[model samples]
Target: METLANLESFVRSAETGSFSAAGRRLALTPAAVSRNVAMLERNLGVRLFQRSTRKLTLTEAGERFLASIGGNLDALQAAIAAMSNDHGEPAGVLKVSLAPSFGVAYVMPLLPDFLQRYPAIRPEWHFENRAIDLIAEGFDAAIGGGFELAPGLVSRPLAPAHIVAVASPAYLRERTLPADPAMLNVMDGIVMRSGRTGRTRHWTMRDAAGNEVATTMRERIVVSDPAAMREAALLGLGVALLAVPDVLPWIERGELVRVLPRWYADAGAISLYYPTRTLMPGKTRAFIDHVVEAFRRDGLAQRLAGSLGL
Candidate 1:
């Protein structure tokens, strides 16, 4: 049988489209991954990949080989891990992806307890704002929403991704509060620009009475990140549309006030995502259970609903 390392290197490199990214997932050096792939190719008497300075592409033989072996690799690894009793202690690197603002505010606190429970598991987390391909990127799990639910993946709802209009108390002190969502157009607006599209987003606000109004604001400040938008609002620059979970603390502390108390935008649900495998790693399973339980216990889902009363 070929070495497990060689097979793992080849599989991860193919999935991530580069040896460097595969190395990050496997905890191996890029040179080490390349060497393993080379040894595998030498033994099989076929070139597995077409290598160029700019990119790596699989050969026809490589594509066929990957198709035959890709799905089986996880099962095989799980079996080996089970046999070696790695599952007993739930040990290994646990890689996860998360949105920066949300992860830092809510999830990071759970790390202390998580580590205490599973001392053998090491966490390697990436804080990013874009959707991620969990399987291709070799992430054990991810937290956020708007991810494509591709095959072999599962998403569990954590909280409602509801957006509510907010502004600093100082900014609202002198100005008249809008009687309806349409009036927001005349106010200074701090808007978010889509990182992927570079266009400002507009949302239709819905009231508890089943009334919907499309609100367009005069853009006084524009930012690419949600956190930056929040800061701009806090600076009394303009009104900002933000997720309730992000500004809940500020609202409670009298730092920020809701612009339209009865209206909110339904942006979908924040979810925890993971690979849908029967033989999932113990560390991943543990983390998922921990997060779900915590959210439920804290009533985070109910608390995060921006339109709770309406």
Candidate 2:
């Protein structure tokens, strides 16, 4: 029988199309992953992958072998996890990805407690702004909004990603407070340009009274990042559309005020994303449970709701 490490390396390399990516997932060096795959090929006496400088493409035999063992690997891992749980504590490097601003403000605070509970687990966090391929990038988990749900991934919503209009108190002092989103056209607008499409995004705002209106803004300042938009609004540059969680602190501090309290754009849910494996690594499972519990205990879902912004 081949070693589990060798089989895992081959499967991960096939899934990611690169040894480096597989190594990232397995916490091995790229060379180590490559060696394991080679050893597996030697043991089987078959050429499994056509290796190139850029990527690894599986041969016909390799494809057949992958199809045969894919489900078995998941089951085997699950069994090993179950047995490990019975013998040891949850311990490993927990790799996760999250939005910089949101992660720092909310999730980072939970670190002390998480460490206290899972002393053997180490956190490897990547604070990034864009959506990432969880499996390909070897992220154990991710947290953010507006992520495309790739295959074998599941999303657990923590809060609504509702966009609210906001402006710094200093900026609004001299300007008229818009009663509605339509009136925002006359005001200086700090707007976001989509990173993928390279176009400014407009939104339609809705109220509790079932009223909906398309928002129009002057686009006086345009930024690719939400953090920049928030900063610009803080500098009294213009009104900005921001997620409720992003501006909630400033709004409570009296530094920023909601321009249209009754109106907000429904973006999506801020979610916890993970691969849909039958059983997960103990560290990953612990982290997910901890975050979910924290969100519930703090009432973050309700607090982050845009409809509650008034």
Candidate 3:
């Protein structure tokens, strides 16, 4: 019989398409992942993956084995969850993935309080702008902003995010603010390269009559990090389309000015997402409750108002 640990590694490697990526998800070294797969192969007496310089591919035998064992593996996971649910106390390490900027600006600050309240539960957090596969990556939950959600995941709205065009007072003084979207083509706008979306950021707006429009401005500075983009804007490098919560403090300090306020659009809701499972573990549930309450008390809208001196 294949060990559960080896089975797990095989499954993750198959799902992620590489042993290195599977190692990242499992917090193991690539060597260790390779060892696990080799051990499983030895036990089964058949090669699972065909090795190659450029890619890893499943063998016919491996595919057949995966088809046979997949449902059983899922059943075992459900059984364990059922057992944990009977304990009635949230206990375990809850792994969560979140956007780096939002995690820094909002979530991280409140985590200490949540940790204090839930002493039995531990959290392991991954902060990045990349979209990770929750099940393959072993994340309990993910926090992000978007309307289109991944299939087979459960998403719950945390709060609504508002996007605004902003520039430093100095930058505004140096350049004429575009009165219309057409004029934006000529303006030097700071564009963000999104790792998740794989495209340059575009500013979105809605007219007075509620017609949605998107404008892709010429990029003066293309940055990947939101914090860096905000800093560049503050230094009068260019105008930036930013989340309201991020630029509100600068606005309040008179360092930055909101531009074309009437044309800004609602970006969408920020959501907490997790793989759809039959029984959610106690630790995951407790974390979700804590996050929901934190948003209720200090949501993005309230943070924006306070930061902007509204």
Candidate 4:
């Protein structure tokens, strides 16, 4: 019979794509991890990985086995660890995906504290903007907005995802402030091209009186990333629609000011998404709680949801 240690070694190697990395997570030498995997392969009479000096690629059988057992493996281990209070600490590699800008600005700040509390957890964070197939890609969790709910995942709302028009003070100087979003048509407009849609983004802003105003600014500049759009506006280029989380620091420092102050687009909630709540590993659960508490401490929901004074 195959030992649980061999199964763990195999799964970690498949997920990390390297024996060295799996060994580091499991606190074993790379040679030892390799031997465990080799033993498992011999017992099963199948090759799980294609080995090369550069990288390890999963064979079809390896992929199938990983898919079958990966989701349940952590929960099972965590349960056993919990049976004895002295060994209740969750210890494993936690792979997560996040948007680069948001992750750096907000989520990264909270990580130090999370690490201090959950010293046994090892986090592998990937910063990206594209939508990821969590299970197919072997990610433990992801943070973003507008993710379509997949078959076995769950999402917990962290903060509001609101977007508003903003520009640098220098750019707005001597220029007539728009009375409404419609007046932006005549202004120099810095806009973003959507990565997902591959088209220029358009905004429909809502105001306090429950009135909506769709912007029709001429695209003086079309940028690809949210950071670039913010930078363009800062260079006195034009007004751009931007997310609060991306531009909040700049706005706080008075580097940027909101246009049409009362109007914002409610993009939805920026949520922490992961595998099913019931099966969530302790590391991921700890991260979710830490993030939510941080947001609550800062009253981030109010700030992002159009509650700020101009």
Best by TM-score: 2
lDDT of each prediction vs. the true structure? 0.89, 0.91, 0.78, 0.83
Runs off by more than 4 Å, candidate 2? 54-70
lDDT by residue (tens digit), candidate 1, 1-310: 6898999999999988899989877878899999999999999999999999979889999999999896688888879766645527777889999988889888998999999999999999999887777876778999998899999899999999999999998999999999888999989999998878889999999988889999999999998888899899999999999998789889888898999988999999999999887667788888998999999899889888898732
- In Å, residue 38's CA in model 1 sits off its true spot by 3.0
Best lDDT among the predictions, by candidate number: 2
The better-scoring model by TM-score among 2 and 4 is 2
lDDT of 4 by residue, 116-211 (tens): 988998989999878787765667789888788898788888888888889999988888889888888988989888777799988888887778
In candidate 4, the residue pairs with backbone N, CA or C atoms under 3 Å apart (3 or more residues apart, or in different chains) clash, namely none
36-100: candidate 3 lDDT, tens digit per residue: 99999998899999988778889999899888886777677777777877865677778999987
**Weakest 10 consecutive residues of candidate 3 by summed lDDT:** 301-310
Global local distance difference test of model 4: 0.83
lDDT of 1 at 157: 92
Query: What RMSD, rounded to one decimal, does every model reach?
Result: 3.0, 2.1, 4.7, 5.2
At residue 73, candidate 1 shows an lDDT of 86
Model 2 lDDT tens row, 58-160:
9999999999996898889999998877788889888899999899999999999999999999999999887687877778899998789988899999999
Winner of 1 and 2 under lDDT:
2
